[model samples]
Target: MSSSVTSPERKKIHPHKFTLWVAMGSIVMMFAGLTSAYVVKKSQSNWLEFPLPKVFWYSTAAILVSSLTIHLALKAFKARQMGRYKNLLTVTVVLGLLFSVLQWMGFGHLQQSGVQLFGVGSNPAASFLGIITGLHVLHVLGGVIALLVIFFRAFSSSRKTYSPVSIEIVSTYWHFVDILWIYLFIFLSVV
Candidate 1:
């Protein structure tokens, strides 16, 4: 043979999953930029540092438990345990909502403690905290919405679409948000 060429095969990821990963990467970049700015701003004047509210811990616990429930839900889906999966998914959705509510309460605590979130007398530090945590809560709400879709689908008597990939994707996104919150909590606590 005069010449021989060989190409290695590439593994493929599901388009939906690939899209989710890309979106997640973008989210990471956005948070990274925001947190970086936070650190830099901290060095400047008029940056008031306040204690993170105790409710944040409760929210963290809620999200962590939600992550567990989502993980279990995915497992149940894979095992064809529809009842368990549906129950676990319901718990995950409730926990997600609880996390969001706790986060709002945490902000209330901050406001009560004289940390103005925004407006004429707001401190930059408190403003940043509000922006970052609020964005995270929005992401959690998005996950909750996704879970609700799956939850409703699971219970639909008209059509039963038991797509494991869909469940897996939702589970992955839920875990991602959960971990992101943990990272943000630690970052806020330390720096």
Candidate 2:
């Protein structure tokens, strides 16, 4: 008697979602390298140690809140509650913008405190911190742009059907950047 072989089915991810995962992986590597360099540079003489700006705490709160709002937005989208989803998404976008503004303010505060971001006589620690945090802010801005795209598409009359894939992608990215910020904040604060 011949035995038949059975194979379990494999679930496929959306191409866009897969692409996003790949991009996020690259970002992780980049940040890891940057932080490693920071650690190595910290041990060298002439490194300046300063307290992180208070505004960073507020920015962290904004990002954390934005993550929750985006998560709820995704749930609402899946539940077909368009109104609630839109409202939540709007809040997430606002929070993202707020986070960016807070970061800028924090930089300003640092400058006021005599931490030169970049110049002929800038400390390596301040320069590294500025570079790392600036990169993170750019990623956050990218997420905000993605949110805006989804927000506009949802409001468009041409949108005839719900695309959970799009919402999922944006939500995942938003959560990623949020978590990334938290990690960086903790690293900077402790180290």
User: What are the lDDT scores of the predictions, listed in order?
Assistant: 0.93, 0.95
lDDT of 1 at 64: 99
Q: Write the per-residue lDDT of candidate 2 for residues 75-136, one digit (tens) a residue.
A: 99999999999899999999999999999999999999999989987899999999999999
Model 1 scores what on Cα lDDT?
A: 0.93
Evaluate residue 72 in candidate 1 and report its C-alpha lDDT on the 0 to 100 scale.
95
**lDDT for position 12 in model 1:** 93
Q: TM-scores of all models? A: 0.94, 0.96
Off by over 4 Å in 1: 1-10
